[model samples]
Target chain A: MTAAAPPLLTVEHLTMRFGGLVAINDLSFTARQRQITAIIGPNGAGKTTVFNCLTGFYKPSVGRLTLTPPNNGGCFLLERMEGFRIAKDAGVARTFQNIRLFAGMSVLENLVVAQHNRLMRASAYSVAGLLGLNRYTRAERQAVELARYWLDRIELTGQADWAAGNLPYGSQRRLEIARAMCTEPCLLCLDEPAAGLNPRESAQLNELLLDIRGQHGIGLLLIEHDMSVVMQISDHVVVLDHGAPIAEGTPDMVSNDPAVIRAYLGAAEGEALPPDVAGGLPTAPPC
Target chain B: MLKDALAAAVVAALLALPLLGFRLADSQQGLSLDYRFAWVGYAAAAVFIGRLGMAFAAAAFSRVFQRKRQTLLPLAGRPSRNRKIVGWLLVAAALLLPLAPFADRNLIDKATLLLIYVMLGWGLNIVVGLAGLLDLGYVAFYAVGAYSYALLSQTFGLSFWLCLPFAGALAACFGILLGFPVLRLRGDYLAIVTLGFGEIVRVVLLNWESLTNGPNGISGIQRPSFFGLPFLAAAPGRTTFHEFFGLPFSPGQRIIFLYYVILVLALATNLFTLRIRRLPIGRAWEALREDETACRSLGINPTRTKLSAFALGAMFAGFAGSFFATRQGFISPESFTFIESAIILAIVVLGGMGSQIGIVLAAILLVGLPEWFRDLQQYRMLAFGGAMVLIMLWRPRGLLASREPTIRLAADALEAAPQTAGEAAR
Candidate 1:
C-alpha cells in the first residue's frame, strides 16, 4: 500500500488450467524488492508453473497478476502482456528450468540478444537507421559495448566467442542468468538454476544470486529444490504442493511447518514431531 | 597431403586462367572478365580466406590483442583503436591497388564480379540462412529489379545510377507482398510458395508481350556509360571512354570499368549487410530462424521479421538485377529461371547458412567451377551435382558447416548446447 515499500510483483488468486487439469490454482503471492525469494516443493508441485505465470508464459485463467513497479508508477497485469512484452515493459525476466541458449551464437551474443528490445527502440528513429545512417552506428556500438560489459560481469570474457550451447552445464546455467540480467529487469525469475549443478557449482550460483540482489538491486524469485541453495540464499520461502501454496515463511519457518513437512518430507516425518511447545523445541519463523 | 595440395593447386590454376590465357568474346584473350567467373572466384576467396584466417587470426589475435577470441576479419569483433587506423590504411591500399601499374585489368574485373556476388550472397543469406526461411524464387526479385531498371531507363532515358534505387524499391514491394500470403506456411511449404512465386514472375515476364516484349526479351538495353562518355572502341563522331581517359582504345577497357562499377556496388552490399548483421534486427532474425514461438514470446513479430528478410533479400537481388541488365546490355526472363534460384540456394547451403564467407566460397565454386569445366560442357552439371552430393555427405551440415545453432532454447535444451561449443572448437 505504501509508496516507499512497493511489492515488486503481486499475484492474487491466480489460476491456470489445461482442459481438465489445473496447473496453478487460486495462488496468491508477492515478490518484494531486493530480496531472494524461493519457491520449493517436490516434482509436479507447480513450482515451475508459478514461474511461468510470473514470466507471462501461461496466462492465468482467472485473477489479477499485478506487477507493481519499484516506484509504484503503474501496475502491469502480467497476464495481459505477452511473454517478451512482460520482460520488456514489466521488467520481468526468467530463466528456463533447463538451460536455453543460442548455442550457435557466441556467449557474448546470447547476452547481447537479451537486450534486443532496447536496441530496437533506439533504432526506431527512421532516417538514422535507414540510408546507411551514422546515428544508428553509434547506438549499435553502445549495444555491443553493453553486451561486452555483461560478459565481463559473468566472468565469461574468455569464452565470449564460444557457442553458448558448448559451455559446461553449469556455465550454460550461469550464462542464462547473465543473459536475463542483460535485459536489466526489475525482477529475475530463475527456474531450477541449480538442478544439475555439483556442490561447488550450486554454491557459485548462490553467490551469483546474492550479487544480483545486492549490487543490481534486482529481486529474485527462484524455484529451486536444492535445500542448501534455498535455505542459504532465500530471504523468504514459499512452499507449494499440487498447484497450491502449502506454506509461506522464512527458510527456517517453511522447513518446520507441519504441512510443508508432510507434503515435502512426508506424512511420517510430520507425525513424529511433537505438538507441545517445550517438546518441539523449535518454532517456525514468520511468513 | 599430396592430394590436398593437388586439389588446391587445381583450384588456383582454374581461377587464374582468365588472367593467363582465357578468351572473352574472342577480341579479349587471356581470361574473360565475365560475371560468372568473377562471382565464382570472389566466393571461393572469401571461404578460403575465412577458414584459413580463422585459424591464423585466432592465434595472432590472442597474442597481440588481449581479446577473448581470435577473429581475423571477424563477423563481429571490433578492431582495436590502433588496428582500426591500420585497417582503414589497408582498405585505402586495396582501393588503389587496381590503379597500380602492375594490376591486371582482368584481375580488376574478376574482383569486381566477386563483389557483386558477395552482395547477392549477403542478400540471399538473410532470407535463407539468418531467417531459416527457404526462398527458392529469389531470382524473381532479381528479374524484377533488372526489368524495372531496363524499362525505366529505356522509357525515361534515366541513368543506371538514378534507376538503381527505384529498381530496389520495386523489388522490395514485391518481397513484402510475397511475405504476407506465405506467412501461414513453414519449411517445405514455404519453399514451395516462394518457388511458385518465382515461376509466376518468370511466366509473366515471358507471356506479358505488351510490357516485357514476350520470350525474345528486351534487347538493345543501353549499356551504362562512364560519366557522359560511352565505352566503345569506335564511335564515328564522338570520343569513346577509352580516348577520354587518354588510354589506347581497347574493348577490355569497357569490361574493366563495368567491373569496377559492380565492385563498388558489391562492396556497398557487403558493408550494408555487415552493418545490419550486427544490429538487434540481425539477432532477431537469428532468433526467429531458431524458434518462431520463442521469438513471439520475446515480442518480435515473426511476420515483420520475415517480411524484413524477404524485402532485404529482394532489394539486393534487385540491385544485382539492375547491374545485370547494365552489364549484359539486355534483359530477359531466361536468366530468372528456377535453376538460377536453385544455384543461389545451393551457394547459401554449401557456404553454410548465415555465414558470409562460406556463401561466397560456395558461389565461387558453383559458378566458377562450372565455367572452368566448360570444355566438358555436358558433363559439367553432372560434376557439379555429384560434388554437391559429396559435400553434403561429408559435411552433412554443408561445405562450411555451421555448428552454432541460431536458437538456444528448444524442445531439447539438453542436446543443443554441446553441439554449439563443439562446432566452434572444431
Candidate 2:
C-alpha cells in the first residue's frame, strides 16, 4: 500500500482515566487507508481502551481523534461526536471483544439490522413500507442483496436462517464481522476478533481480515492478543505496555525491537523469549 | 425421594396447624380453644401420599415419554406450516362465533370481554415483547383512553364514534409523555416507574371530583350506535337500528352488534401489528429488545425506537379502552387499576412475548377459564394462581416459545412474494 495519502484515522495523545486509574495514557497511532493496523499489548496495556476511545464508546480524558474519509467528506472529530454518529455519519463500524450479535434473531436478520438507517429512509419513516409500495420493496430487496453479499463473503450462507446464538464460536465471530461490514464503514475496528478461535480458525480469520482490507479498501484497526495473527496480517504494528506505547513501526521492525521484547517478557534481562514471541518472528537478530 | 416426601409432610403439618390445630370460639362462656388433631393428621397423610404419588408418576411418565421423544413431540419447537393453519382456523372460529347456534347473550358478553383483552395484549406486546420494555403501568394508557371518551362524550354531548379517535390520540400522547422520563431506565427500574405512573393515573381519576366525579364515576355514558342509529327499542324522531333493519327488537341484537364492533376493532389491531412487524420501525423494536447498545452502534436512535413502540402500543390500548367504556355505558377509576395491568402483563408474558397467537391463547386461558368457573367463587383466584404457577413450571419460556423471523433472504422472500401476489390476484 502507498503511504502518500493522508491517514484515514489519526489518534494523538489519547488518555482515558476512570476515577483514580488511567486506562489509556498518552496513546498515539495512525491507521492508513486500505491498510491493516494491529495494536498489540499484554493484558491491561489499554489496547482495548484505545479502541473504545476511537469508536466513541469512551470520551478520552484527552485526545484528538480525526478521520478523513476517501471521498473527502470533511474530517470527523470523533471525540466530539456521539458513538452512533461516529458509526453513522463518519462511517466507522466496530465489533465488540465479545460477540454481540442479536442472538435471538436469525443470522440474516443480524446483517439486515446493520443497514437500519438505509432501510429506515427507504421506508420513508415506515409510511410507504407499511403499504408495501414498490419503492420500499426495491430498497428492501437491495438490502437483502447486500446482506447476502456479506454472508457469502463470510461463508455463512448456509447458516443464514439459524439463530445467531446457535452458531459455533468461530462462526459467531465471523458473523459479527459480517454484521459490522454490512454497515459499509470506511474504518472497521475489531477488538480481539480471534480471541476464542482455534489455530485453524485463527488462520482463516487472518485471511478474512486481509481479504476485507485488500478487496474493499476499508481501513482496519485491530486489537489482538494473538501474536501470530498480529504479526502475519498487519501492515503497521503498535505495541503498548502499561497503558503507553512502547514501539510503533512495520511488523518486522516492531517484532525485533528490544523494547517490545522486554514489554512482553516483563523486563527480564537474560530469560529466553516465549515461544509465541520467538515463533512470531522466525528470523530475529540476537539481542 | 423419601426426603422430599418427608419435607412435604412437614410443610403440610405447618400449613394445617393454623387452620386445624387450634381454633378460638366465642360463646356464652367466652373464648374457648379447640384442638383438631384428626384434621392435622389427615392433612399430613394426604401430603405425604400426594408427594409420593407425584414422584412415582413423574418417573413413570418420563420413562415412557422420553423413549420416543422426537415422535411424540413433533411440533414442540418447529411449528412453521402447522402454526399458520391453526392461526387461520382460530380466526375463522372467532369470526363465526356470534352466528353460531349455541351463542347466547351471556356467551357473547364473555367473548366480547375476551376480545378486549386480546386487543390489550397485542398492544402491550409492542412495548414489552418487541421493545423489551417492562411497562408495569400499561393500564394508565387504558385509563386515559377510557376517561378521554367518557369525559368528551358526557361534557360535549359528542357521539362515541367522534370521541374514539380523540381517546386514542390522548392515550398516545400520554404514552409519549411517560416514555420520555423513563427512556434511560431499563428492566426493574422502568417497571417500578411505570407502576407508579399507573397508580398516579388511577389516583388522579379518583380525586378529580369536578372532572371525574370522584369514586362515583361517570354513568349514563353513551353507547356506540350503528352509524348514527341507536340500538334502541324506539326513538321519538329518528329510526332505531332494529326499526331500520325491519326486525323484531331483541336485546341480543345490540349485544351481537357490540360483539362485532369489538371483533372488528380487535382484528384491526392484530392486522396493524402484523403489518408493522415487517416494517423498519418494527425491526428496530426487535433489535432494541435484543440489544440497545448494538442498536445504537447500528445508528438506531434508541429513544425514537422505544418511543414509537410505547406510542403505538398505547394507541391500541386506547382503542380498546374506548370500546370498553362505550360497551359498559360507564367509566370509573375502579375499572383501571394495577391489578388490571398485572393481568394484561401476565397475558403477554404467559403468551410468550412477541407471539400474536400466544397472546390470544393466554388471554383465553387466564380470562376465559376463570370466568367459566365463576361458580367456584371462593376458590376462583386460588385456582387461577395455581394454574399460572403450573404453566410457569411446565413452560417457563412460554406456551409458544419458538420464534419465526420477520425477515428472510432472497431465496425465501422470492418464494413468499410470488405466492402472496398470486393470492392477491385471486
Candidate 3:
C-alpha cells in the first residue's frame, strides 16, 4: 500500500493497562483506506484488546485513536468517545471472535438492525414509524434493499427469515460479516473472523474479505489465525507478540521475519529463552 | 434404579422426620410431643415413586429423542394458522363476555381486574420481554400513575381525563430516573436494584403523608367519563352516560363502562407493542436484548434503547394505574406492594416473555382462575402454586409461547421463531 493512499485509522502511542498488568504497551499502527490490514498474533497477544480500545469498549490508559472516513466525517478521536458514538459517529464497526449476531432476530432483521442509525433518522426517532408515514416507509424499504444486497452477496438470502442463532456456524460467520457491512462503516474491525470455520469456509471468508476490501472503499482491520486468510488476502500485516508489534510489513515480509517465527514457535525450544516470554506459544499454526 | 429410588426415599424420610414425625401439641398443662409419623411415611413414599418414574422417563426420553432434539429446537415457536385462529377466538370471547347470559356484576368486575393484569403484563413485556430488562419495580410506575391521578384530581379538582396525561408523564419520568442508574447493570444485578427501587417507592408513599395522605390514601378522586358524559345516574340537572344514551338508569352501567375502558387501554397497549416491533426502535430493543455489546458495536445506543423501553413500559403502566384508581374509587401504597410486582412478573414469564397473545392466556390463568375460585378461599394460593408448578413442568415456557417475527423476508419461511430456548431463563 502506498503511503499517499491516506490512512483510514491512525493509532498513536496506544497503551492499555488492567491494574498492574500492561495488556498492550505502546502499540501503534495506521491502516490505510481500501486496505486489508491483518493483525496476526499468538494467543494472549492482546489483539482483541487493541480492537476493544479502537471500538470504545475500553478506554486505553494512554492513547490516541483517530479514524477519518473518506466521506468527510470529521476525524473521530475514538479513545475519548462513548462506546456507541465510536460506531455511531466515527463509523467503526466490528464483529466478535465469538459471533455476536442478534441471535433472536431473523437474518434479515439482523441486517436491518445494522442500519438502525439511518432508519432511526428517517423514522424521525420512531414517531413517523409509529404512524407508518411515507418517508419512513421509503427509508425502511431502502434499508431492506441494502440488507437484501448484502444477503445476496453473502449468499444468505434463503435463510433471511431464520433466527440468526439457528444458522450453521459457517453461515453465522458470513452473516456476521454481512451485518457489519450493513453498517456502512468506514473502518471494519474483525476479531478472529475465521476462528471456527472449516477449511472451505475459511477460504470463502478470505475471498469475502478480499471482495470487501477491493470494492467497498472500506478499511478492514482483521485479527486472523488462519494463515491462508492473512497471507492470501491481506494488503499489510502486523505481527504482535507480548502485546507489542514484533514485525510489520507486507504479509510475505512478516511471515519471513525471524521475530515472528520466534514468537509463534518459541525460540526453537531450549535455546535459552528469555525470562519474560509473555505466555505459552502454540506448537503449530491454528489453521 | 430401584436401589437408587430406595436411597432417595430414605433421605427424604430422614429430612421430613423432624418436621412431620413429631409436632408440639398444645395441651392443657404444657406442650407435648405428638407423633404424626404417618405423614413422614407418605412423604417418603411420594419421593420414592416420583424419583423412580422420573428416572425411567429420562432414560426413555434420551433413548427416543437424543438426536432429534437438536434439530427440533428451532421448530418450537412457530405460530401455525390454527394458533392464530385460537388467539383471535380468545379475543372475541373476551370482547363478547359482557353480553353472555351468565354475566353478572361480580363476574364483570372480576373480568375487569383480569384485564388490568393483562394490560400490566403487556406493558411490562416491553421492558422485560422485548428489551430483556427485568424490572422488578414496574409496580412503582403503576403506583405513581395511580397516585398522580389521585392527588392531581383531588387537589386541583381536575377531571380524570385531564389528569391522565399527567399521571402517565409522571410515571415516565420516574421510569427514566430509575433507568439511569440501572442501565449499567444486567440480568440479576439489574433485577436486584429494581426490586429495591419498588420497595423504595412504596416506602416513600407510606411516609410522605403530607402529599400522598400516607396510609389513608387520597379518596373522592374524579372518575373518567365517556367523551364528555359521566358514567353515573342522571341527576336532576346533569346527564349521565345512561341518560345520554336514553337507556334506563342501572348501576351495571358503571361496571360495564369501566370494563370497556380497561379493555380499550389494554388493546391499545397491545397494538402499540405490535406496531413498534416492526419499527426501528422495537427491532433495536430485540437486538439490544440479544447482546448489549453487539448493539454498541453496531452503533445502536444501549442506554437510549433500554431507557425508551423502560419509559414506554412505565407509561403504559401509568395509564393502567390511573384506570385502576378510578375503577376502585380508592388508592393506597398497600395496593402496589412487592407481591403485585411478583404477580406482574409472573404473568410476563408465564405468558412467555415476548409473546403477545400469551399474556392474554396467562392473565386468564393467573388472574381469572383465582377470582373465579374465590370460593376456594384458603386453598386459592395452594391451587395457584400447584398450577404454576404443573405448567412449568409441562411447557417450561408458557401456555402459548409462540414468537412469530414481526417481519419476514424469505419466501414461505417457517412460521416458528428460532429463539426457542434460553434468554427467558434470565
Candidate 4:
C-alpha cells in the first residue's frame, strides 16, 4: 500500500504467437498492488492474449511476468505456473470475456464450487482421520467459513438457489466475478467487466473496482473496451495496438499521450478529452 | 381422457394374453397365445401408464402450488429418506414379480432380457449422458464379457457365479485400456474410434474359433442354477422345485428364478450408478461434460475423468453380457454387433440421459414393443426407429432432462447477492 512497496505484477517484453500471427508482441507493463490497472486496445491488439498469458491461459513466446506483493518479501514468476496451479499456489484468479458460470448449477453452488480445491483438501484429511490414518477437521470448517464470507461479500444472498443459467444476464455477469473472487485471489484479472453496461451500471462497476482494490488490497488487471470506464477508474493505463504496447503511464498522462489517443480514439480526436479528467491523472507514476 | 381409457383397455387385453391359451381356446381350430408376447404387452402398458401418470401429476401439482411442476418427480426435490424406501420397494417388486404364482414362464424370460438391455442402456448412459461422450462401440465390451465367461467357464468348469466377476473384471480392464489411448479425441472422432473398437471385438470373436467356436458360437453353455439346485427335468426321482414345495412341477419356476437373478442385477446397477453420481468423481464427470476448459481450470484431470466414465460404462456392459450368456445358455458374435450398441444408445437418448427411471421406461418401450410386434416383425423396427425420432423431436434435451444442479449451497448463503447495477460496482 506504500510507495516503497514493489508493484504486484511486472511484465517484461512478453511475446506470443499463433503460427504466422504474432498475437502479443513485446508487451511490457506492471500492475501495482491496491490499484486498478486497465489494458485497452482495438480488437486483435492482444489485450486478451496478455491477460491469458498472465493467468496461464497462454504460454508467452518470450519475456517474463513477476508478481510482487504489498505485504510480502519477494516477487514470483507467474508464467511458470499452470492455469489451475496458478490459481491455487499463487492466488491468481480470473473471469472470462464470455461468462463461464456453470449453467445447470445454482448461483450459490457456482460460488461454493469456486472454493472446491480447499474443500477437497479438507475432506481428504477428515476421511483419512476417520479411518485412524490422520487428524484434523480444521480445514473443513475454514473452507465453509471462507465460502460464507464471500457469499456475503457478493450480495447474492437472495438468488442463491436459482440455477445460474436462469439468472438475468447482468446478474450472471456479477456471479461470474464473485465466483472468481471466492478463490480469494491476490490479483484479479477481469476481461471486459464493463463491456455491456449502461451508464449507471458502468458507474457502479467503477465503484466496485475501487472498493475491491481499497478493501482487499488486491491488484486489478482489467481488459476493457469501454474508454469511459478505463479513463474513470484505472489508476494506471497500458495501451496496446497491433499486438504491442504503445503507451504506459498514469491515467491522465496516458490520456494526453498522442499514441494512446490515436490507438484508442483515432488520430483526429486523440487529445480531445475534457480538461478536468486529464488534470486528475497522476504524473510520473512509479511502477 | 379418451387416450387414457384406450390405453387402459389395451393394458387389460395384454394382461389377459398369458391366460388366453388356457381359457380362450376351444378344442377345434388350434390357435394359442404365446407367453412372451403377453410379457411384452404388460411391459408396454406399464411404461405408458407410468409416463402419463407422471406427466399429469407434475402438471396438476404445479398448477395448484404455483411452483415448478418438475420438482414433484424423484431426484428433483431435496434428497429425502422416503426416496430410499421407494427405491428399495421398486427393487423388491422388480425381483419378486417372477416369483408370483400366476407369472408365465416365457413372460418371465422375456422380461429378464428386457432388464439386461435396461442395464446396458444405463451403462451407456454414463458415457453419453454423464460425460457427454458418445460411444457407439459399447456392445464390444458386452462381447468381451460374454466370451470371457463362456470361454473360462466351459474350459475350466468354473461356476457361473465365479465367472461373472471375472467377466466384469476382464471387460473393465479392456475398457481402461481403450480409455487410455483415445482420451483426447472429441466429438465425431471419438464416436468413430468407439464404433471401430466395437467392430474390432466382434471380428476377434468370429476369427478366434478355438476359443469362441467361430461362427457356430459356443453352445451347451451352462444356465445358472440357484443354490446348486437344477430345475426339475420331469423324470422320476429328479427333485423338481415345485415338488420341493409339495406342489406340481411347472416350467414357470425356472423362468421365475432367472427373472429374479437378472432383476437383482439390474437393480444393483441402478443403485451403484446413483451412489457414484453423488460422489466427487461423478461431479467431476458432470463438470467435464458441461465445459472441458472450465473443468481443467478447476484442477480436474480431464483424461482421468473421461477414462473413469469409459471403464465404469464397460463394467456394466460386462455384467449384462455375462448375465445374457447364463440366461440363454448360448453365445454368438451376431448378438454383439453395431446394431446392438445403436439400440442401447437410442434407449439412453430416448430415456433422458442420466435419468435412471427414464432409462427403465425407455428400455421397455424400445425392446419390449418390438418383440410384442413380432407378428408384424418386418414393420416393427421401422415403427421403433420412427418412434425414437418423434420422441427426440418432442423432447430435444431427452425425456426427463436434468433441470437442476446436483451440488449446491443451502438457502441462506445469499446474503451478499449482487442486485441492481449500482451495488455490483461497489
Candidate 5:
C-alpha cells in the first residue's frame, strides 16, 4: 500500500454471475489519481463485466465498488447507484467498446449533451432556458468553451459541426473519449477504444490517453485487447482468464509473469516465454 | 423484354384463372359453372403491357439520371441550402390561403381541420420523432384534452380560453401516468403498451356514460373567442369581433377567425419546438433518441428525460384537442381512435422524423389531400394507404428526411478553430 497516493476508485471482492455462469470472480484492484489502470485478458475473460459492474450497468452478485473523488468531494458506493447516478453524482464516465456517439448530432452537440446535468441545473430544468435567461446563456457558453477545449485536444475542432457518425472511425473513437471527458468524470473507463484502429491510430490513442491522465489529473480504467496499448501506457495491469485474475502488477511484471504468459499462450506448464512474449503477452497486433 | 413480358403474362393468367375465368352461376336446375375465359385473357394482356411499360421506364430513368443520382445520393442526409426558401413559401401559402379567391368558407373550414392535424403531428413529433419513443396511443391524450375541456366548460360554464390550459395540464398528467409504467420498455413493447393505452382511454370514455355521456359524446362545447369577444353576432351592447371592428359580419368571419387562431397556435408550437431544440432538455431528448445507453453513461437520467418528453408532447396534443373540440362543438370516444393516432404518427414519420418543415408538408399531403378526396368515402382510406406505401418506396427516410444537426455553430466560431489550417496535414 502506497500512502503517497490516494485511491480514487477501489473494487474489492467483485463477483458477477449470470444464471449458472460466473462472468467475473473475486476481482480486486485500486486505481489512484493521475494513473491508468488497464485490464487485459484473453477472450471471455470477464474484462468488460468488470467495467459493467463498476459503471453500475450490472449488479455484481457479490462485490463492493466504491468511488471517492479528490478533495473530499464525495464517497459513492457505485454498485448501489443507478447507471446515471454513477455518472452524474459519482462522476464516473465510460465509453463503449463499440463506439456509441450520437451519430446524427454534430460532434459539438455530442459533447454538449454530456454536460447535460450541469446545464440542466443552470436552466432550472429547462424553464429558464426556454425563457432565454442570461444565466442559461452564460452556462451554455461555458459548456461550449469546455467542448471546444476537448475538440482541440483530439484535433476535431475543424470538424466539430460534422455529424458525429459521418466522421472517420479513428475520429469517432477519439470523439467518444472527448465526450466521456466532457462529463468531467473523476474516473474515465474506456472499453477497447483501439479495437479496430491501425497501428498509427493506436499510437495516437496512447498519446490522447496519456495527455488525459497527465493534464486532467484523473484516474483512468482501461479494458484493452491490444497488447501494445496495454504494455506501453498503462501504469498498472491486471490479467484475467475465465473470470479470475491470474496476475496483477506493473505492466513489466505482468508481462514477464509465467502465469500471465501461460494464460495468454495456453501453453504447457514451465514452457519458455517467446522473445516478444516477455515484453507483451501474446505479442498481439504486431506493434 | 418480350420474353420477360410473356413470362409475366403467363403468371398473371394462371393467378387470374380461378377468379376471372370461371364463376358459379345458378341455373334453373342447379348451380352450373360458367366459363368467361376472355376475362382471363384481358388480365394477362394487362399484365403483359404493364410489364413492358415498366421495363422501358426503368431503362429510360436509369439512363437519364444515373449521373445525377451519384451527385445527389451523397448529399441526401444533409438539409438542402434552399430549404429556407421552401419553408418561407409554405408559410406564405398558409397565411394567404383563407383570403384567396378560391377559398370560400367550405375550403377555409377544411383548411382549419387540416391545421388541427398539422398541430397534432407537430406535437407527436416531439415524442416519436426527436425522442424516438414509438407512441401508438398518442390519441388517448388527445381524447383526454378534448374531454377535459368539454366537461369543464359544460359543468362550470367555463369559457374555452379559461379551459385550454387546464385541458393541456390534465392531458400532460395522464401522459406522465402512461410514461412511468413503460420507462423501461422500448421499440415494440413500448408501442404495444401505448396502443393499449389509447384503446383503454377510448373504452373508458365509451363505457363511462355518467361522466363522459358514453358513446353519445359531449356536445354543445363552447366556441373559442378572440380574448373575451365571441365570434357570434352582437347582442345588446356587447360586440362581436366584426362588430367591434365596424365591419360587415359574414358567417365567413367566424371561419376566418378560427383559421387564424389555429394558425397562431400551430406557429407557437413550431416556434417553441424550434427554440427548445437548442436548449439542454431538447438536446438531451435528441441524444436519448440517438443512443439511450450512451445517454445513461453521460449522466442523463433516462426516466426523467423520457417523462418530460411524454408530458410536453401530450400537452401539445391536449392543446390541439381543445381546438378540435371548439371547432366541431362536439366530442366523443369515436373522435379519438387508434386510426387517429396512426394518422398523426404517419404525419410525423412521413415528414422525416425530426424535421419541422417536413411535418407541415406531410400534414398537407396526408391530411389535406385525403379531405379533398372525401368523395371516395371508404376508398379514401385505401388511397391514403396506397399513397403512403408509394412514398415509403420513394423516400424510405421520409421525404426531406435530412438528419441535419439541430444546431450548427456560427461561421465565425468555425473560423476561430485553430486547427482549420492544421487539418490539411492531418
Candidate 6:
C-alpha cells in the first residue's frame, strides 16, 4: 500500500452524543484499503461507538463518514444512509460483540442468508425461484458453493446441518466472521472478535483475520480488548479515552506511548507517573 | 406424591366451598340457594383424585423421558427420512377422506371446518412463525375478505368466482395497510397493535350498518356454483349441478362438494406456503424472525420482507374468509371476533410455528377434537382448555419439533466429476 492511494473509509470529526453524554467525540481516522485498523481502548472509551457510526447504526451528532468503494465506483456518505442501506448499498458488513448468528437457522443457512440481496435478485423477487427456473437454480448452486467454501474455511462443515446456536462457542464466533465475509463486504467492521476465547482460539482468530485481509483485500475496522491480538496483527492503531483519540500510529508506536498507558490505568492527567510503570512499558506487548 | 394429593385435596375443598356448598337455582317464585353436601363431597373427592393422578402420571412420564437426556437439546437437526414418509401419509389420508365409504354429512362438514382452520393456521404462520411478526389481528384480513365478497356479490351481482380474487386482493391491501404502522414494532408491541387492528375492523363492520348490514350481517350470500350451475334442486329454467351431472340431488351432495372446494383451497394454500418457504424471500422471513439487526446487516430490507409476509398471510386469510362466507351463506363481525384470532394464533403456536404439516395436525386436534366431543356440552371447552394445557406442558416446542433446512450441499455435489473421453481411455 502506498500513501498516495486513498483510504477506503474516512471518519472526520465523528461525534455521537447520547442525551447529555458524548459517547464518541471528534474522532477522525482513515482505514486504508486491505489493511487492518484496530481501535483499542479501556472500558467505556467509546471504541464500539466509532464502529456504530461508520456502520450507520447510530447517526453521529456531527461528522462525515465516507466509504470509497473499490474501482472508484463511488464514495458512500455512510452516516447519511440507513443502517441496512449502509450494508446493502455501501457494501459494509459487521459482526456484533456478543455473537449474533441466526440461532435457530442452520450454519449453512446463516451463510446463505448473508448473500440474501444477491440471491433475491437472481430469484427475480422470488418468482423465478418459486418456479424452479434455471437462473435461480444456478444462483442457488453458486450460493451453496459459497456456503460450503466458508464452512470448510471455518472448519464447520460437519455442523452445517446443525442449528447455529448448537455450535461450540469458538466455532460460533468463526461462523459469525464467515457469515460477514459471505456478504462480500467492501469493509468489515468487527466488534470484539476475540472476546470469550481461549489463547489458541485467539491465535486462530488472528490467522483468520490475516487471511481475510490477505485474500479478500477488504478493509477491516476492529474493536478489540485483547492487547496481544491488536499489537500482533494491527497495521494501524487508534487509542480512544473519554470518547476522543488519545494516540494514533503503528501498534508499536501507540503501545509505547505514555498517554496510552495512563489511559489504560485510569490515572488522572498530569499525575506523577510511576518510574517503574513508565519504564516497564514493553516494547513488544506480550500476547 | 402423597403430599401432592393432600395439597390437591385442600385446594379442591377450597374450590368446592362455594359451588358445592350451595347452588343458585331459579325457582318459579324467586332465586333460591340449595344445599348439595353429598354432591359437593363427591366433586371434591373427584378433583382430589384427578389432581393426584395427573401429578403421578406427569412425574412418571418425565422420569421415563428424561432418564436418557438430562439436558435440553436442540431438536432442529435435519428432519429424518421418517418425517417425509409421515408427511406423505398425512396428505394421502386427507385426499382419501371424502371418498371413504363411511363418510357422512356431519363428518365431511367437520372436516371442512378443520381444513378451514388449517388454512388459517398456515396463513398466520407466515407472520407469526416465519417472519416472527406477532400479528394478533390476523382475523381482520378474514373480515375484510368476507365483507369484500359479500358486498361485491350483493351490490354488483358478481358471482363467487369473481369475488374470490377480489376478496383476496382487498384483504392483501388491508394487510399492507396494517403492516405500515407496525413496521418498527416487534414482539409484544406488535402483538398489541395487531390486536387493536383486529378489534378496529370488527367494530367498523359492526357499526357500518349500510355496508355490512351491521349486527344483522349479510345473509343469503350465494353458495359457490360449479361453473354456471348452481348446487340446488333442478327446476324448469334453472340448470342445477346434479341435473348437469346426471345424478340424484341429495343434500349430502352439496355438503360433499363444499368439502372438496375447501380441501382444494386449503391444499393450494399449503403448496404455495411450502414452495415460498424455499425461495429467497422465504429465507429472508426466517432470518428476520431470528434477528432483525442481523437481517439488516446482511442487506435484507426488513420492511419489504415483513410486509410481504403480512400481505401474503393476510391474502390467504382473505381467501379462507371468502370461502367461510360462501359456505355458511352469511358474514358477520361476530364471526371475526378476537376469539377467532386467538384460536387461529393458538393453532399456529400449538402446531409448532412454521411447520406446515404441524398446522394440519393441530387443527384436527384443536378444531376437530372439540367438535367430536360436542356431546360433552358445557364441559367441552373445559376439556379443550385442559387438553391444550397438557399438550403445551408435554411439548413446549409443539408436537413436531424438527426444522428442515431450506438448502443443502447435496451429497452428490461432493462426488467425482464426469470423466472426459481421453481421461476415461487413460
The ten-residue window of minimal lDDT in model 5 chain A covers A267-276
- Give me the overall lDDT of model 3: 0.86
B1-426 in candidate 2: lDDT tens per residue? 889999999999999999899989887899999889889999999999989988888787886645643332221123378778988998999989988999999999999999999999999999998899999999999999998999999899999889989999999999999999999999999999999999999999999999999899989989888989989998899989999989999888889999999888988988888988888788889989998878777778788898998999999999899899999998899999899999999999999998899999999999999988999999999999999998997668677766787776656533433322321232
Give per-residue CA lDDT, model 1, range B1-426, as digits (tens).
334444554576576656643435534565544435665565556545644655565566666644322332222233235534643564475478677897676566555555566667878988998888999999999999999999998899999888999999999999999999998688999999999999999999999999999889899888888887898887789888878878888777777778778767766776776667667788888877766654544445567778988998899999999999988887788888999888888888888887666776677788766755678978888998888886785455665554332222222322322334442453
Compute the interface RMSD for candidate 1.
8.4
Docking verdict class for candidate 4: incorrect
Compute the DockQ of candidate 3: 0.47
lDDT of 3 by residue, A34-132 (tens): 998999777888899999999999999998998989989578899999999988888899999999988877888899999999999999999999999
Displacement of residue A18 (Cα, Å) in model 3 is 1.8
Q: Give the better candidate number (2 or 3) by DockQ.
A: 3
Per-residue lDDT of A1-287 in model 6, one digit per residue for the tens? 45455699998999999999999889999988988999978778898888888777788899998899987678999999988989998899999998999998888899999999999999999999888999999998899899988887887765676678877788899999999999999999999999988999999999999999999999999998776688788899998998999999987788678898878666333333333434576552322
TM-score (chain B) for model 4? 0.75
Q: Residue-wise lDDT of candidate 4 within A1-287, one digit each (tens)?
A: 34344588989999999999999888888788888888976677888888888878788889999977556676668899776677766777788898887777666557656665665554462244233232224553454466556555555555566667666666676777877877778899899988677877678778777888888889899988777888788888888888988988776787777676555444223233324433445552211
TM-score of 1: 0.73
Regions of candidate 5 where Cα sits further than 4 Å from its true position:
A1-3, A267-287, B1-81, B234-237, B376-379, B413-426
Could you say which candidate leads in lDDT? 5
Per-residue alpha-carbon lDDT of candidate 4 for residues B153-195, written as tens digits (9 for 90 to 100): 8899888899888998888888888888788788899899999
**Tens digit of lDDT per residue, candidate 3, span B157-264?**
888888888989999999999999998999999999999999999999999999998999878777788887887775567778887888988888889889988988
What is the CA-based DockQ of model 5? 0.54
DockQ values per model? 0.13, 0.43, 0.47, 0.22, 0.54, 0.47
The better candidate by DockQ, 3 or 5, is: 5
TM-score of chain B, candidates 1 onward in order = 0.71, 0.90, 0.90, 0.75, 0.88, 0.87
